[model samples]
Target: MPPRPPVPRLAGDGKGEGTVLQVRRLRGGDAGAYQALRLAGLRLHPDAFGSSWEEEADRPLATTAEALEANYVAGCERDGALIGIAGLRRATSVKTRHRGVIWGIYVDPAARGLGVGERLIAAVIEQARGQVEDLLLTVSAHNATAISLYRRFGFEDYGLDHRSLKIGDGYVDELLMKLDLRPA
Candidate 1:
């Protein structure tokens, strides 16, 4: 398969403030930045993520880079820094190859409300359009912002996993959502 083309700068109401939000799939070389942002997300919002800081904080950059090479990762760059990221991966098993899951979606606090998250998701959907018939994700039942964003993109709740993630002494419920990309 040919390499996917880079994502163009998604339009926003920046006017002339220089808040251009460009979305693109992160490559192997971006592993360091991706790791940093990912760890930050896990730290700042422990309940929002399934992975704990202790588990991934010590992961080597090489391991993260290799993961980037293996998955479809969409990143949002403001100016020159990677402030947001979302990743998608198609199932490898023959019974589930038609499914793709979006994971580790995060945006910096400073970049929120500027459409960065939406653009990241849009890029992922565009990438998944013809490659997979269904896109799936699990979001913490309490993360309203993320849930709303996914709903705007046509994802529908199909089930719920009670106590999906056990963080410290509490459990975080996860809402399973899926978007059907196949047409009638």
Candidate 2:
């Protein structure tokens, strides 16, 4: 298969003071920045994700770079810094090829509420179009903000996991959501 062309950079309005938000697919070269942002999220919001900070923080750069190339990871940059990221995990198996996952979406705390998350998700969906028939994600049941954002993008809650993620001594239930990319 030929290489996938680089996704063109998308420009969007950032909140206040002439901030310009640049959203684009992150590449292997972006490992350092991506790791920083991702580790921050994992450390700051342990219950929000299935992956733990301890597990990913120590991962080698080569592995992170390899993972970046294996998946569609979108990064939102503001003033030359990676402030937000979202990833599309497309399936490899033929039976599940019609499905993809929206994963590892995180926006720096300071950049939240300025539509950074929304743009990251939009970029993921744009890349998923024509590539998958459906996109799915599991958000922590307690994360109303993230859940609402997913709903805004047309994701419907299909089920709930009673206790899916165990973080430290607590458990977090997850809401299973899906968005159909096909017309009914």
Candidate 3:
């Protein structure tokens, strides 16, 4: 693949008055920032994330860097602080090569409703467009905000995976959503 394009910085809420979120491709040096934001998300919204902080904490820095390099990792930074992140991983199976999975989507509580998640998702979708026929993602059924956001981007629910995650003593259902990029 060609060198990933530099993340574009756009005007956000001027300084602290609002929120100025810059969405761009993540790099090797961003492993710590990514890890921090990711762990925060997993802690705050356990059902929204597939991986736990415990699973990621012991991971090698090289592994994190490799993920940033191999996958389409986008981050939303405000005032030089990383507050949000999303990633798109291309399917490796031969039959699923035309699809990409959207994962690790998280925005800090303080950054919600400031368009940071929207920008991050938009960047990921734009990056996935040419490389895959469709983008697939799983979201907690109870996450209305994210569901609305994905719907606004033309993603539609195809099915539900009931009892997909065993959280604590109960199970949670996940909604499977897909955004088709093929010509109509």
Candidate 4:
């Protein structure tokens, strides 16, 4: 198949005022930009992600493309540049199909505080709705900004994952959060 054409940026919700931001499910063709952004996130904020830059920096583009093919990743683009991303993957097992996990959420520091993160999460939630009963995510305990964003979207802290990640002999605890998408 011919390479998937680039998706045009969607008009931003008036919230950004003059900033033109768009969120869409990334395609295999987006692997390069996605990989660059992922590595940047891992390198710039090692504590926020479980994967280290060293572990993924050398991974091939095919691996990233295949991964994107297997999951739902929403990329937030501004002026045609990928600035933020979040992924949602539904459980594949028969018994766990009702669940979806959100991961790899990141926004370029230059784009922070412009609602790019919010748009990314909203895109993930919108995509996951109806397909999964619950949307779950884990965030570093010290990331108050992310916690607040999750809370605003109705995700509540369910428990703590002690020592979830170990980086250079230092352990990081994570807050397990869940958002129930099913109606009561």
Candidate 5:
């Protein structure tokens, strides 16, 4: 197997000056923190995330723990508070092994603008390098900040899912984006 990718160390502005936030592969023990951050993201940015907090709030800890243990990178306090998480799950069929979907990307609002999201995405890209030839994700069309971030990370828009999600009494469009990482 290829070596695990290098972990990203991002700096945060929490300690009066700056402190390094550790980004590492999440384990089963991090399920609660992972769920907490994810739920917070959904609550704060409902249009930006695919899953709703209402839907996920009742998920069992075991399910969250399995997800964290299976395929997730978490950014957290060195002392043990999980502030961000991103996941890459490989497609099931053999022909789809070269592709992976990015999901559950969330960073605590308190940790925003501190490079946590960048570190999380970098970790995702690094992990996808060998296993996947392409990666895909969807973002709310109105999420300009996220779109800009994805663009900076080399993703390109391929299409849009019109009114993909029902929000309030209406709907929101989803911008489909892909990043190709195959060796040339």
Candidate 6:
């Protein structure tokens, strides 16, 4: 098949916003782009992620492919380029099977105000609803933007994890947040 054409960035949404996004499941073939974007996030903002660029940088591409297939990962696209990702990793033990962790929520800097993060998050939430009773994530304590966005989705801060990340000379604290999906 001739390569599929790029989705025009301004063609949808009917509002001339200059960005049209398609948030969907990412498969193994998407590993390269996923890894690139993920590594960029880790390198650009070291405190935001628990993993370091050095740790993931040396892994083979196949490792990334395996991860894409193993987890519930959603990718957002604009103009045919993968721009954002979010993942939902369910608990393996039966006792904790009713919950999942929301991880790796990142949007390219260019896509920040265009709702890319929320789209990735919403897709994860949609996929997670019937599968888990609660969703949890950790955000850097100093990241007000992410905390606010998660709050808008009804996530509540449950606790603080001090010294969550030690990047260079300083420690970064993390805020533990959760969104209950249980019917109350």
**RMSD after CA superposition, every candidate:** 5.3, 5.9, 5.6, 7.8, 4.5, 8.2
Clashes by residue pair, model 4: none
Cα-lDDT of candidate 6: 0.86
Positional deviation of 28 in candidate 1, in angstroms? 1.4
lDDT of 5 by residue, 131-172 (tens): 898899999898898887787777889999999999799899
lDDT of 2 by residue, 67-182 (tens): 99888899999889999999999998999999999999899999886678878888898899999989999999999999978887788899999889987688899999998886
lDDT of 6 by residue, 146-181 (tens): 897888777889999999889989999999998887
Q: What TM value does model 4 have? A: 0.90
Query: Candidate 2's C-alpha lDDT?
Result: 0.87
lDDT of 4 by residue, 1-184 (tens): 2232222243344586668788899999999999999999999999999899999999999999999988899999988999999999899999999999999999999888778888898899889988998899999999999998888788889999999999999999999998888855
Q: What local distance difference test score does each model get?
A: 0.87, 0.87, 0.84, 0.89, 0.80, 0.86
- For model 6, give the 10-residue run with minimal summed lDDT: 1-10
Question: Lowest summed lDDT over 10 consecutive residues: which window, candidate 5?
Answer: 1-10
| Model 1 C-alpha lDDT per residue in residues 11-130, reported as the tens digit of each score | 454564556778898988999999999999999999888888899999999999999888889999988899999999899899999999998899999888778988998899889988
> Can you give the TM-score per candidate against the true fold?
0.90, 0.89, 0.88, 0.90, 0.86, 0.90
In candidate 3, stretches whose alpha carbon ends up further than 4 angstroms from where it belongs are 1-18
Model 5 segments beyond 4 Å from truth?
1-18
State which candidate, 1 or 3, has the greater TM-score: 1
Q: lDDT (0-100) at residue 4 of candidate 2? A: 30
Which segments of model 2 are wrong by more than 4 Å?
1-18
The superposed Cα distance between candidate 2 and the true structure at residue 60, in angstroms, equals: 0.8
Q: After superposition, how far is residue 122 of candidate 3 from its true place, in Å?
A: 0.5
